[model samples]
Target: MTITEPVPTGPATTLPGALSLRAEKQPDETAYVYLRDGEEPDGSLTYRQLEADARSRAAALAAAGLGGGSAVLLYPSGLEFVRALLGCMYARVAGAPVQVPRRATGLARLRRIAEDAGTTTVLTTAEVKHDLEERFGDHPDLAGLTLVDTGALPRAEWTGGFPEPEDIALLQYTSGSTGDPKGVMVTHANFLANVAETEELWPVGPDGVVVSWLPLFHDMGMLFGVLMPLSSGMPAYLMAPDAFVRSPGRWLAAIDRFRGTHAAAPSFAYELCVKAQEEGKVAPGLDLSSWRVAANGAEPVRWRAIRSFAETFAAAGFRPEASCPGYGLAENTLKATGSRLGEEPPVLWVDSVALRADRVELSAPGEGAQPLVGSGVPVLDSVVRIVEPASRTVLAEREVGEIWVSGPCVAAGYHGRPQESEETFRATIAGQEEAGRFLRTGDLGFVHDGELFVTGRLKDVIIRQGRNFYPQDIELSAETSAPGLHPNAAAAFSVDDGERERLVVVVEADGRALRTTPLDELEARIRTAVHEGQRLDVDEVVVVRRGFLPRTTSGKVQRRACRARYLNGELKAAAAAERSAR
Candidate 1:
């Protein structure tokens, strides 16, 4: 169904303004609760406390002449990042939340982001500042940065007016799964619009509580863990991403503890939780009855993950309808489409052969069918159109093509990237020029029965003999082909062998399995599976130890990077393969 323009939720223009209103309305209400190690509460902030802390930081930022400029917020996941971000809003400084570098590659990425934003100021905690200073001698690029400890900022009253609606509030950097990261300029208006659209779609009740372990630097985490809860006047319980990674059960325990009504993660997270339960990692007799929405986004929504999670958690009071698959990107300010609340996510089985032929044909569950989970319809006030990338012509329903979106929720553009911003954010639809510019999302999807079914990324499509083959299909086949392959740790791409493109599948194998199973036998299994499943010959199969494959900060496999490493012979194959090569 078509979504019309959404009604304004409130008079608050900026995020700071919304927080102030909430503080005035309910000063004693808890705004945020930080979980230390994802188990015990470390600290909690009331609305009054949060507003005061943010104002104090804002005053300090203004006094430091940071207004109208961007500052990198380099902090671990905690309440400090939240306060600093809100302070930036109050002081009219665009906050760029970046993940703290932990390695050489991470430090390089940090330098690139800092250089791209043209910012010298970094707002971080005292501990982080000291650590960076100690390491600055090794990395000269980071040595020149001016780090300000937000905790040391004096507690002064902020008198400055809130930023305007169109003012840039954040410089959200892309995950760079495909390429270099680009900072999307999300304005105050874009933030509010997206939050409003989310509320309209999800409609959080007064008793709603948000429990999240998503990284604050990522778009989904920022919106769901912070902005959405604040906008909805709900309390949020947040924990560091590492905590959740260490034990997926911590996330569920937090939900049970806080009676959390809303939570979101990628499809892999749900799979992890299912695995954790199967391995008896989750606490016994845990009641997740309070979880109203289990949003799965930021990656491909897998039907296997959805079904497995529902069945595994059914005894814990987790309803099947709580699985809400969604589609979004940083360019759209977070959410583009979400499954309707309190409804089972739609799943469609299609003929795999027809899908390769760029056609959607209904098929029953069988050997040649693929199950696709719907990511729901366009959110309120947003317009989604499927367009043929080559001709830029809108496609009919169920016809797979590039997804284009238009709405106020769309970010202003990429920061300092005029040409790329213009090309990506300002595209006119063929024969519909009057409708205005649309953001060309490089994703492939189609609308079937008014529900969006994301197929794959347009750039990741592998063309062989004039037919399109999606990498995800091949990756799925490869993962199931071998018994020891790590789930979602496979990258499938094509390499040019001078004459034609040859298919190569690079996968991560369990270390224990590599020791127990023969390398040749494992490779044979994968090759046989791909040949049987997709009827495509595998040119090469590279197996490496778990966590060796290249991945984005958000945990998405970087196929291009993997392909480059394979060609450069930089990838160190598993022990067995290495020994076999010798």
Candidate 2:
């Protein structure tokens, strides 16, 4: 399953310049479909038209005194936003896209990203104009910067031109919901290689139409929804995230309406679709038979979510083989591993206890508390291996270790922050960090029968009583043990109190439901479950309101934010106090 085979469709055309290689293959095909407010819910642009628009925007940016190697920040996702990114490519300028937060507190995230990049020229939209102006307008580092509005940009200014493949095309910033976001430097060559590899691994035929609600700022959305379709000569059906959040049914409806055959999303998205189905929100008689590839990646993939989604949507003709779950990161240009075009879901069940103890022991269903989905074998030309955390020695099959990856898919390295880059990007073979450099994924997992299975995170592993426990396992147990707890709402982490580590379980409570229940019963239920199911002695079980969980725009829970609130005495430890009163 190592990535060494040529793409079934064959190599891309010899492009004279970067961004042109893929564009040359499909000049008249639709590249992007944008959803906007007050206007038509969707807009489409062909490869030729998008290229022209990008060139015009690039010329305008060049006229504004920006040129090759200059870094610009892109904030919004739409047809115009895509045009601006293309403009950067046409002008030989590099641009980074950051995740724009919907709330005010998210401004701090943007500021942190700006500080990390040390740039000022930002591409924004009218909706976020005031917020950006107020939050970052007066900053010294951003002086003399231009904040271009994608919606208001004049289309008459751009004229089609081309840039070199060696020229820097984009700088997509990582969604540092975990830590500081780094600007990943990508050239036109990187995009071509990745797109070629993706097409190789999962071929999209001429009739294929892509539909996606994933944000364009994100790597998967931009690469697959916007870039790959153009390269593959396919149309994309796009809707806004708000549209899908408001009515997930619309996502399926669009697929039915457009006959979309290709799409991608995180694991939670499928879970949301399943919830929407349970609420009877899915339109009747809608068909998804045309959906040949529904890629699941970008974050941790849960087996429960995948199976639930497949079962719920079976009546809609969504094939089990169509649901592809895999692995990747922004550093690898969005895709690393995924199911073949028409294969059943790849999965592996492992013993929950031995998995926590540096052992990659497999188990049958119902024998373990958790079963992780396999992210599939490496894509064409990519390599995946598991290495021991301390020694970096390559472990054999079914040996739990830190995942190390190499191949053409790995990005060059992070932009700036050399020391941090060295630590993360350098690979260790035979006890040396510099032995052979591969992207240190910081993820804990192993290979079984040549398939990659990610259990959880290495840093997120909670150590207590000389035993390693995965927070994901404890979190899942709490959600299953309690009727009211929201799935994935609970976070379990270990904190030190001058001695051994103490296990802290934080679950968002159904505030109204808790208020009605007898306090004794609620506390008893939580305490019993933590001790019995997880086999961990908990010092505290803090429960907040139902809507208390902090999340990134991509819907990932912000555990650090929860920990911060718990430490500051903002969250009530109702369960913990109830147990003490006994």
Candidate 3:
């Protein structure tokens, strides 16, 4: 680990981004370390070597007549996936790294996304060659499309190269919730802003090692795991998501083995590790003192999850101050706001009754109701405002409204969708005529003590008898109060009952643990908790088997998918679905 002095304050180059410059400037430093498959020796690349590979591949694609504007999709995460994406950057091509669907793997999604991007080239590994051949080998739309597999072809050689900071580096796929995923155009300017912002807020030196198992398809995973480390000339320890899922203890072990200093994950991961500890599944005695930045993001942060995990791992030398809460979306590149390293978790308690009735009220803990975790102030060069969702009135701090972001890090817009882009990015704010044009986040939150506290998405909120309710509030209550409920294994949604919406919570029950506790009593207690904790009338409490809740490859709960299945009559209670056949 070598320390590269920071570039002095001056006019910054917005194009071709930081990664390309770091590759050229620190070519000999280790850029990445891929944990070899099947227990082989780990594979690594220096900054120079990785850049050379990217340049060679870009030149190769150009020689093959696939250059600018050509779209290529990588298979989730790996050294190959990242190198190919960088190659796209080097060639000035728009790259889309997609999540390979487990049900129907192939160029099915690729062909559609490429067609949208006007792309004729696709990059992938040999493992999915047969699927691609079977799915789109004969499709008329894929005619003349070039499919390059690095697994089969020898590595292309390069002479030398670099890209400008203004070039389009990657086309990030967004809307993992509903409709066909749309591409978010990210330029070198966009990429550099995210890197600088993250570095400024949570500075990591060249001596740092980033250990990640996040799927690289998503922007956060790709930026944090690959680009962030590479730009800083730090080494990254990578592993397959399956390995982490099978044994989360391996993640902690990997950190201990590599003496990793920085890591990031969603709240569910923290909950999962806590469960592993409670079940005696994870081995004890792993040292986590080397960790400095433990970022919790990609979804809403649950304070309980953080507290529980910190308590369980405190004896292992994990510091609570290292825990960082952040907020970001694909539209703002990868990062937006994060608590600085070695800072206490920030929380804002508010009047529970006022929060539900009026939507904006902040107070001290015990004086009010629930204590919510704050998302922290915006990073340097970014400005966040809570404004009226309809009129765009910039409200004072502590006034709850739609969260809006305006800054250099804010992305240009959604790719290929002018209508959606106009609606999301073109909103006018009260104040300066040209400045404070906030990006409507569709998220409801308030600013308290100069810190942002996100409650829930505006679209995801349930309205009942003129009072507002967030699903997370009810879900968290059930997890805390239910006896047999699996940790962090519950979802709350709303169903219309003609006049108003009704609350429905589905808890993933631990079947083995349920035998000792009465099901009737457990259900009653959960219902009571929800009613008392959140003041919502429970319509139904469906307890299903563990591992039944569907999640994205990146470990985010597919709430829309769950709601779709629930409405389509596919999801059912474990006992009822079993008894029906008998």
**Runs with alpha carbons beyond 4 Å of true place in candidate 2:** 1-28, 36-40, 71-74, 130-145, 151-166, 177-179, 431-435, 481-484, 509-527, 530-532, 568-582
The sequence of per-residue lDDT tens digits that candidate 1 reaches over residues 1-582 is 111223234678889888888887888999999999998999999988898899889989999898889889899989999999999998988888888887667777777788888898989999898887787646876767888999999888787777789999999998764347799999989999999888877889989999999999889999999999888899999999999988999999999989999999998889889988988999999999999899999456999999999999999999999988989999999999999998999999999888887899999998989899999878667999999988999999999999999999999999999999999999998888998999999999999989999998988888887777888888888888866675678999998999999999987888676888777788888899888888888998888888888776667788888888887876644544655743
Clashes of 1: 0
User: By descending TM-score, how would the candidates be arranged?
Assistant: 1, 3, 2
lDDT of 1 at 466: 75
Residue 171 Cα positional deviation in candidate 2, in Å, after optimal superposition: 2.2
> Which candidate's TM-score is highest?
1
Cα lDDT tens digits, model 2, 1-582, are 111223224444312243354455666766766655312456778777776666666667777767665555555656776777777776777777766655445555565566666666677777677776776677653456566775566554544345555555677777645356687766666777778777776888868888888777778888877778766667776667777767777888888888889888877678778877887888899899888888888456888888897788888888888878778887777777776778886677667678768786667877454577888878667778888878868898888888887776677677787787777776667755564578888888888777888877878888766678877767766766565666667878777778767778777666554766665565567667777766777777776666666665465666666676667766655445634544
For each candidate in the order shown, give its overall lDDT on alpha carbons. 0.87, 0.71, 0.73
Which structure is stronger by lDDT: 2 or 3?
Answer: 3
Error of 1 at 382 (Å): 0.6
Q: What tens-digit string does per-residue lDDT give for candidate 3 at 1-582?
A: 121234323434532235546655676877787775312336777777775677677767777666667676757457787777777776677888766644432345655677767777678877665566676667764576677785454456543244556666788876455336677777777787888889887888756999888888877788888878866668888877777777777778778888888888888788878888888888778898898888888456778877888899999999999888899888888777788777877876678878876456667767347778877668778888888887778888777788888887777777788998888976777656587465777878888778788888888777777887877888888887855665557788887769776677877777664665566677788899888887777888776677777665466656676777677766664547743533
- Candidate 2: lDDT of 55? 62
Q: Give candidate 3's total backbone clashes.
A: 8
**RMSD (CA, Å), each prediction:** 4.4, 5.6, 4.2
